[model samples]
Target: MDGIIVRRVIPSDNSCLFNAVGYVMDHDKNKAPELRQVIAATVASDPVKYSEAFLGKPNEEYFSWIQDSEKWGVVLTWLLLFYSEGAIELSILADYYGREIAAYDIQTTRCDLYGQEKKYSERVMLIYDGLHYDALAMSPFEGAPEEFDQTIFAVRKDRTIGPAEGLAHNFVKEQQRKRSYTDTANFTLRCGVCQIGVIGQKEAVEHAQATGHANFQEYR
Candidate 1:
């Protein structure tokens, strides 16, 4: 990998994880909800395979909540292994927060189960800073920074670069510096109708209902 670059998705949405996965997989962000449904249904339909201990919730309830847009989490890496009958490599940015955490890797290979064997190739990198998720990409760069191409950032699971441990450390440090002067007293939510700023999710939703504003954006 030479002169790698990371392309960031739009921020401040509860769907960051799904959107990040979609961006890396070359799918529409809107498809995330559907993918979530498929994962949930797959788990629900076969509770014996995806045991309660693994799912961490009752099959039906977990299935319903996972499909909700506001629910922002995933057990897809495991689910994908079962769905595709293949392998998956998940690389996580461990020290994204101001903490000393060990960077780790999870490799899940297809196993002989139900006498079903299929072949597929998929690998994904997810960047988590304890709160948000983002995708990463690296490619050769020869053009000016301003004129750098975006298509080059598409997902390429088969290709990988360095561990980039230094990059993770430096990014956390920069975030910490920015936080020192940032006032994060309350989560801000902006109404879509009148564009009024409200604090807290409950209050924001109440204000929206009262003012006939159904849309809102959250800023943390």
Candidate 2:
């Protein structure tokens, strides 16, 4: 076996923070602090405020254990910063077999988290980019075993760049496509960046080969 295993991060989602921060630390492992600062500067986010969202809500005991698990601490930290000030619309999870489940936990929790306040603005909408979470939560398959399905949360809904089922030859495509679409109130296509949408197939083939970064498998 390749030694990869997947599990649902629920029944108390303490692991989400760990996995998120670990990804940041590991992925940025080689970057020096100054270089990271340059990158962080481009992020346009406030780490301190975002960190607060990481502690959004967990029972004291479970929260402590999650913070203490060394394996995922860094990942969790990054995730907190990534989603800190940003409102969470929803989240999705998918496993090797491709069973997809989406949820509006971010929105629902925001309501419970913020709306309960006496003077909070009802104008604060959970604001879903799409209804994939609505569809998944409204789905009736939670009892299924090992079904860690949440691809939509991680995929783009655009006709260009990515649409999960669309062509994307790398993680850059996956992550960047998301940043392009879901991180804001709207998404737009960059003809220079994602010309694959309008260009002819053969032309796109030539364009993709121009970078030597794409393959047919990107569609699958």
TM-score of 2: 0.20
C-alpha lDDT score of every prediction, in listed order: 0.42, 0.26
Q: Report the lDDT tens digits of candidate 1 across residue range 47-96.
A: 88666555544667767866777655222212222332111111111111
lDDT of 1: 0.42
Model 2: CA > 4 A from native: 1-14, 19-142, 147-220
Model 1 weakest lDDT span, ten residues long:
89-98
Residue 117, candidate 2: C-alpha displacement in angstroms: 32
Residue 128 of candidate 1: its Cα lDDT?
Answer: 50
lDDT of 2 by residue, 1-220 (tens): 1111122232112233223222222321122233223323322243443243344433332234332433122222222233532223111111211222222232222221222222211111111222111111111243443333322223223312123222112322343345422322222222334534323234433444465323221120
How does residue 108 of candidate 2 score in lDDT? 26
Where model 1 places Cα greater than 4 Å from the true spot, the runs are 73-122, 139-220
